[model samples]
Target: MSGHDHVRFLTKNMRVDLALIAGMIAPGSRVLDIGCGDGSLIDHLFQTKACDARGIEIDMAEVTQAVAYGLPVMHGDADVDLAHYPDNAFDYVVLSRALQAVERPREVLAQMLRIGTRAVVSFPNFGHWLVRWQLLATGRMPMTATWDRPWHETPNIHPCTIRDFFILCEEEGYVVEQWLAADDGGRRTPWRRFLNLANIFGEQGVFLLRRR
Candidate 1:
């Protein structure tokens, strides 16, 4: 099946970023999902890919709900608890759509790469043309599906663009194995191949990475 078809087939309720994260993972791999929300992706991975999936969410309510559904989830903060995992404990560590919200994005990514052979990270892009135009037009934050929350009500503290992330990876000596820019509709374009266009048009991005 195509990647989009696989993601669409696996989950109808998942966000586009989560679907892309799922598509990046290898089947039957041990996976750690940070900021996994209510464990929809974890559940999907376990049932569909035969993965031994576990999740860490900061929300107690979400943890409760996921536990009730028989998903292995712990109420934990990504910024604080990611350090506790031993090195190379999982095949893939995923942080989907939560990178900008984390207190220490660089630190969390370092820990993720340390604990797993591969890491999947996804987040909304602040450099989209709409955002830039909105800032220029109204001098205010733009409202899009991926970044719909108002500035006062949002958890995101460190919004970055695809270019910004690339610079961060370069500084941290991480390797970008694969990356793509996706629209809010879960459709992925050749963002990696045609990056300049993607940076302006793509609403979000997903990346598969490892340490150098």
Candidate 2:
């Protein structure tokens, strides 16, 4: 059976970022999941919301696995391949935990907005208090649950803070529809009420954006 056919009891297991992204999506909309590791989120959306969900993953092994499980996933690089998709082909284009790793984040985001009506982005916050404390105390790169890899081995080439992201959005003239910040344990705070505090305290951030 395809992964979509057997998608069951898995949404509950999604990471906090994925769950947040799901809530931002409207039911039955077309979705293009960029850097979709194993097609889990797309499969969940397809099964529960009857959405048309497809994915692009850079890892060939992951792509093969997702396809074998009956998900419509293709092997592709997000930075290079996003240009090939026509304008507004999908309702949502998601880049979950993969933004920092892209070669050109600005270009990738521009393409995402071009190809989809809205874009969802989730990434770990490099300015969390814990990260700051660790760096201050140890004079080394900090590691958190979401950013488990050592600095030398990490794929995040352009790690950024929540405030940085907001500034980037403002500079690019993208409209932020909604956003949230949470701790590593997935507990969300009244982050909207205090964006700066959230930048230092929150472990991760998810944003819903649209062209201005």
Candidate 3:
């Protein structure tokens, strides 16, 4: 599909993030998206760029929706199911806004990298200035739109910062190819320069990484 067709299919809220991932992926590449809620990204990739797309989702409702769109998807968890794929089965793997909910982030990431040549990961930045201020002053867990859950009801079990992610990546032997920070609606921010410090100030961040 043409670039114009790609842009026309995406909602305003999804455009920036989708474009970021699209930029990194070669046309017609094979892709595997983990935690692919509703398969929106995969659908976009298949419909617009002719990418060979597949998804793994834990949510059955989302799995239904993804299948309804004629997208290939399996019901499974990232931490466990990625082991089924052979080494370098896909050109790219994606984990968007789902890492924080995983029980073993490092393990999942390692598996993802092994299964795909490159990976794109996007997550809420727990170190944004607003979150910091809220914690510093109120001493309460944050409840921003991105993290809109009461402490007792939250699904995110491993909230982390950009610095934490970088350290984890280094220890796991993954190289950071590119990094971008985003706000609530996927709007880009100038937080790349302060990635380590970004945990104290960035709202969200995305990383393009490759296995070492």
The numbered model that scores best in lDDT is 2
Clashing pairs in 2: 3-69
Estimate every model's Cα lDDT from 0 to 1.
Answer: 0.82, 0.83, 0.77
lDDT (C-alpha) at residue 46 in model 2: 97
Task: Give the distance in Å from residue 98's predicted Cα in candidate 1 to where it truly belongs.
Answer: 0.2
Candidate 2 lDDT over 63-180, as tens digits, reads 8889999999998888899999999999999988777778899999999999999999987789888889899999989886656668776667788999999999999999999998
- Number of clashes recorded per candidate: 0, 1, 3
Reference-based lDDT, residue 40, model 2: 89
TM-score of 3: 0.89
Clash pairs for candidate 1: none
lDDT of 1 by residue, 1-212 (tens): 11222222223325666668888899999999987777898998998899999998876766788899999999888888888999999999998877887778999999999999999988878989989898899988887666666887666778999889989999999999999998877688766578788889888888999988
lDDT of 3 by residue, 104-159 (tens): 88888889899999999977778777777788899999877666768776667788
Find the 10 residues in a row with the least total lDDT in model 1.
1-10
